[model samples]
Target: MYLFLVLSLHTLWVAVSIAMQHGHYDMCKTQTKSDEGIVWEYMACQPESRDMTPYLKVKLEPPNSTCGDPPEPFCAMGNPYMCNNECDASTKELAHPPELMFDSEGRNPSTFWQSVTWKNYPAPLQINVTLSWGKTIELTQNIAITFESGRPEKMILEKSLDYGLTWQPYQFYAADCLDAFRMEPKSVKDLTSSTVLDIICTEEYSTGYATHTKTISFEIKDRFAIFAGPRLHNMASLYSQLDTTKNLRDFFTVTDLRIRLLKPATGATFVDERNLERYFYAISDIKIHGRCKCNLHANSCTFTNNRLACDCEHNTTGQDCERCKKNYQGQAWSPGSYLTIPKGTANICVSSMPSNCYCYGHSNRCTYIEVVNTAVCVGCRHNTHGQQCEKCKKGFHRNGSAKLDDVNVCIANICDNELLRCQNGGVCHNNMRCLCPSGYTGILCEKQKCEDTGSCSSKSGQESVSHNLYLITMIIVTRLCTF
Candidate 1:
């Protein structure tokens, strides 16, 4: 609900005339992109009321102009178009145009105002302006730029956090009209007189072209100035940033702002003479959101240069400091970050996943210990050991030392060195089992179970030996008996 006003440069010709006729620049349109990246342009947003008055300072002087009688009071040569002109019916007096780019009323009715000319200038004209808050402020995830000129050829934005000494390309929000078309708000006011319509219709303007019949059909299309892009006579364009690593608050604190106009609107030579050769450019407004002011007290957020920064605890990071940091993976939820969803809003939701420690082939297993910031891998597998289950365990040898990413490389010894194989011709299997011989069995086949003896000689010699033994045995027995 909080809106921070930045720059407002209502640049459209019709809006300029309306602002000139009226006292304020309320005729200009404004664009607002929600957190979901859906753009909403208030054709009658009248954001001049929210102009960033205090911080705006015109760094370069634009062409000068004066308001005089006879709206087209004939002026001789040498004195070119006055910036802004208005005549008083009562006193026949002409008033000076307002400083900054806001003074838009001009004498030429066909063209909005006599534009600053650069036809014969030595180089291309560039408009440079700076915005500052007098103190630093936290930035949001995106910056929205609105233009009034409707048809400026080119514009580039840059930012400097260190007071203009250095600058980097500030990313423009990427946009698409495809999905955004269905999400356009229906309750918006008509955009027939809108600056965006002017840009759309004028794209194809030519010298002899008469009227544009496409306006009627474009108006009936139920289009939104913000949600659809201006396709000559169609809808407003969509804008967003995809795959952008840097968010609006990534800068943390911004002290200065700058906008450079590389290409501007050149007078359409095809248009009536009143608008011929008059080149100009104008920006309607800018809006940016930042870190919540309440974060300083409740969330321990730090305050710098009138801005608040969330005091993100280690292993946690986000705008509200509610999400876990990378590696310390976890999905975090906090009421502080998002309070409630607004009605009628369309959002591309991203689902959250629970955080867990990750490990490869276990040098160690991951164990989630409460109160510890990082999970520890405890029981390593594959004979590996380390905080991340990466290194080899003490007694294990690593295979292919050259492969750094190989996780299952560690090898362990399965048997004692003395028993590398079964001893005494035993067969070893699985580094532990030893197959022994038929008559030998032991841990290493070292103990013998049976003894081997030899057999007798020839058959005849065996028979003679048998008879002699029998006689000798009988004689010995008889002698023992007699004794």
Candidate 2:
């Protein structure tokens, strides 16, 4: 019986492990058979979601927002008579430091980060709590801020995409949304597929002060449910939408978050100016769940040198695998796609080859040049020539309105020093046309102004004679040099 039970347990563990990796992109490439024998088949991938609080750096604005700088006393919100709590920066046990907000909580008396009391009543006791990751991350779960004191009556949760260069509101919390932010309150459930990106103010977490109700949240899963179904069982549908929509994908991406504490919870309609110590902010914990934004080109992220970065794959590089590696620019770089379900498109960058060249479909043959140690496209079609047939040959210019692969991308020059040479002392202007002299006319200045009206004077005749002499001398010199 013991041996049978152990076998069953081992089987169950394997099943559980498989389930855990079901939809998560834990593999970046797999070996597969092809015409060239065994080869690697890459696929779009991303890291698994995890608790991100431990990887963040927290900062408090106003520089001295945390309490206990000068040792202060504070009363409880429920009972003003209980004035036993003290905050002293010098004493570790009595001090309420910022790090306590992220510390593990299960102690008999939970540790917390507390702000100074609202001593100056009628003036707002404001604080800004900023959390930075120094890298882009995509939200995978709700952001919960557990307040040791009563939930703040007015606060704004903001996010930054460009590393704190700018910020936009993620959510607003207040007892009266209209009064605080001039907007009607709406819950995440009210959002739909068409309005999933709307930023709304919520009054749900800022109501009457209930002792058990201390957590305020910004709902991320609820917004995702607008497309992924209520239980998130239709993740393929969600992934499809994210793959096609750029704005929707960026909605969950952030580099930093800031909690703007505009007003503390004043239980009553009016503040009790007589006992202002009862009004202050205290937070016990903050929870953030996310994954590093790897542009779907990596399956793992690592923390190094006090910073988080994605372990890039598919011949890609950068903090987020945002560009193709050097020598792998045979094609323009593109982010991996989540379409085609299950194993999405890898969009892998192709390496530059010394033979069997890649010339953007403009050339089929190439020469292995020894000097450059690279392939040069030979006899490129479409009037294109270069190492990779990416440039227009001489006497031709690129058509700005045409794509690089289009045959019309390289148009013949209206005037050039070769076959289409400008005459009558005209010069080529940007290779588009000839800037003719005052006495010249026609596209290439081949016709004189007097010839247009059929008026030939002695002076015009003399000019024509000189022009013929010049052409003959050039032809004689060209023949002698050729021989």
Candidate 3:
């Protein structure tokens, strides 16, 4: 029993290790031993790929696009005489809603969302299935749509990045690519790295009405293979390309996806005017696998309050972790890099405090100067102030006894125009001292000198003096000079 348990645990460990390797950026931070002790080391991270359909809000245009508003009878796609299928919106068993397209499958007879039959033929029966996540997402797998009736003869998959404000065609599908979209037919397998982003019409999925060929897909992995190689064993190459190429990265990112069904499948060359019931769009399932677009700053996305949001890390806060948090803008906001493979650059937002701004420990805050294209240290401590807190401020001197990074490296001035001004007609000399006149004495020349013996005796007789007067003065002077 002990041996069996050990084997089971080993098997579980292997499975977990494989999963971690598959999703390398699943963790945002890790603890490691350093000279300063265990500290959090951050890296580029992203949420795990998951079924994104459940998080989507599906909408069909033309409001009344669904079938069975008034009970309707539909026939099978292969036979026009088989017209026994009755659809009634009022009946629960026969009703088909849009939500059925995303529902779980595996039932004997699949449930589907059927559009109103092409009763108004030659008008072009078109339906738009818009799946909105309301938040940005990055696709990691193929988008597959299964049809219960038949795969549409002409369809177009589109993506929107600005929450549906604009749209662009992702791929086109048609029985005749040149006729439908006016583009040459190109399969994903035929694409190279240079042509990966090119949108082309594919006849692969739209050609047949066979029962087994009911699924139409937008190929994501095939495109990824152009750079990653077949089987995707070298994902680092793909990641490197994606990191450096903004267009490629944007290709996989979307806030919304739209499936435009332009034409229904007819078993033959022409549509039968008599059996219009069999010529409707019916979708059983749509599988979308993706992760939230967190700018590589987060490893988890949560659905809350009926919306999806990334659980941001690396001092980032946004729906997609697109910007830095309020107090962490020491540097300009940037997306993390996937280049230095395994543990990519986090590009974490540094704290606004001067000491955390990479100012060589002299300051915690820094300000990005857009004009100069640089970050200058702000409120530098230890009398330091410069772009990197590497220079001594005016009226201060560099300590000869300490290193540049030392806390006491920038020595305070003995006398300056500000708080350390000279007095009693004394002249300031190079911020190191106040050169006193003959009658005055002290560091800032603030004291009056009793030069004559008679005046000194009278002053001494009038006021009682501490026995350790010299020692006290020296201690005060030392304290004033120290940081």
Candidate 4:
């Protein structure tokens, strides 16, 4: 089996075929996650080294047509693509760390590697990818990512929601639905680590497949390192754009590294420093699997500096906005964009990162961007500002840099008596206090909470500001419960 990691950072269209794909499956394991948004994670997965072609082809075809005219596209099953132990260790050195890498000093001690085969139905097209190896393999399950490339043409993805029994057309994260998607081979934690991913594809109804796989994405990283030799480590963080309307495309780059043992410092007893020179390697691959709605060739999107972007004027995903469906932004969805992580990996077995909050230093403010589900962002309770909800919101005309934070503003009405409600979201001034709405927060809850802050108008001059606030507060409270 051959392994290839593809990361698209620039120039979207690309196709590469190399003879030497030998990599690894090896020895130790380390994984770590921090409270900060940044995390250092490491793991080792072992492969079963068993032939998975039979099960790989194991498919659950869609049910009989339920409607008079099902739709514009359809899917069909064909012969299985066989994997007759194509793995060769001789070329395995290719699997070794590249001459230049970082973090990991060119040593991958994991177990087996996994392979992926994609057939675009009827029988004319196919794409195959391989998985890298590490010290201690960590996953054991069927996995696959629903990704596609080629210029911005209206591309469609489909998948079987019921474990491949029936298929459905997929709509991307909604950013014109042309961005890529993926799924890693999944395996039961206690189950055997040796397993292959199962994916069903069809060119006849590719449009349908695109839809079917709408809810899928592959591992951005796993146990293997595509770039070796001087490669290795656990450090990756997620960051979005300041504006929702920018272009972004994935890109991967390997770096060179050098490790040296240290010897203890004279004054700092515990701080040790030594002498040992080791090479480091890294492999960064960006793969584009979601087809483009533009119908242009695949390599059109790419990244510049560190930003992903697309070729289209407003083509949400690709080089300019290759991250179409859901490009990360300080604000959730300034334009039309949104998304989520897979439910399959929600448990500790996988992991869940905290929702981002725009609260800094207890900025008691509450604001929601378009589709910025509250569940995805955790904010300060009393007062705070900025992301992380750590600052105080503007309230009751309070001025001076001495901003109120986690302040006991709204005692009974909206704060849940937690002494810290409406931090940076927005607020309602009442009885020498601020009735902070879950939405409106900040010091005074004056920052129109939602993307489009509702006008807190007093009912046609009836002094119903209190009443209007009552309605808005109720509306906001109910919304939070549902999430």
Off by over 4 Å in 4: 1-21, 24-48, 52-162, 166-358, 361-379, 383-386, 390-483
Greater-TM-score candidate between 3 and 4: 3
Best by TM-score: 3
RMSD in angstroms, candidate 4? 28.2
For candidate 4, what is the lDDT? 0.26
Question: Which stretches in model 1 have alpha-carbon errors above 4 Å?
Answer: 1-122, 127-285, 289-315, 318-327, 330-419, 440-483
Each model's number of backbone clashes?
Answer: 31, 0, 8, 208
Tens digits of per-residue lDDT, candidate 1, 1-483, equal: 123222234335565554433222132123567887866432211112222333333343343322222243322111225434333222323322223233332533222222243433446656655555443444532444434343344343456766577775442111111222222222213344233222122122111111221110113122222333343222112111101213422333455666555444433422223532344443433444443322121224454655434444333455444454554442232212111111111111122222223456342224444465455666666667776666676545566653434654765432233423344566655444457777544554433333122233356345545645664565466458645
lDDT score, residue 387, model 3? Answer: 86
**Candidate 2 residue runs with Cα over 4 Å from true position:** 1-22, 354-384, 387-483
* Each prediction's TM-score versus the true structure: 0.32, 0.75, 0.76, 0.19
Question: Which one wins by lDDT: 2 or 4?
Answer: 2
Give candidate 3 regions above 4 Å deviation: 1-23, 356-365, 377-483
lDDT (CA) for every model shown? Answer: 0.37, 0.86, 0.86, 0.26
What residue pairs are clashing in model 2? none
Cα lDDT of candidate 2 equals 0.86
TM-score order, best first, reads 3, 2, 1, 4
Candidate 1 vs 2: which has more TM-score:
2
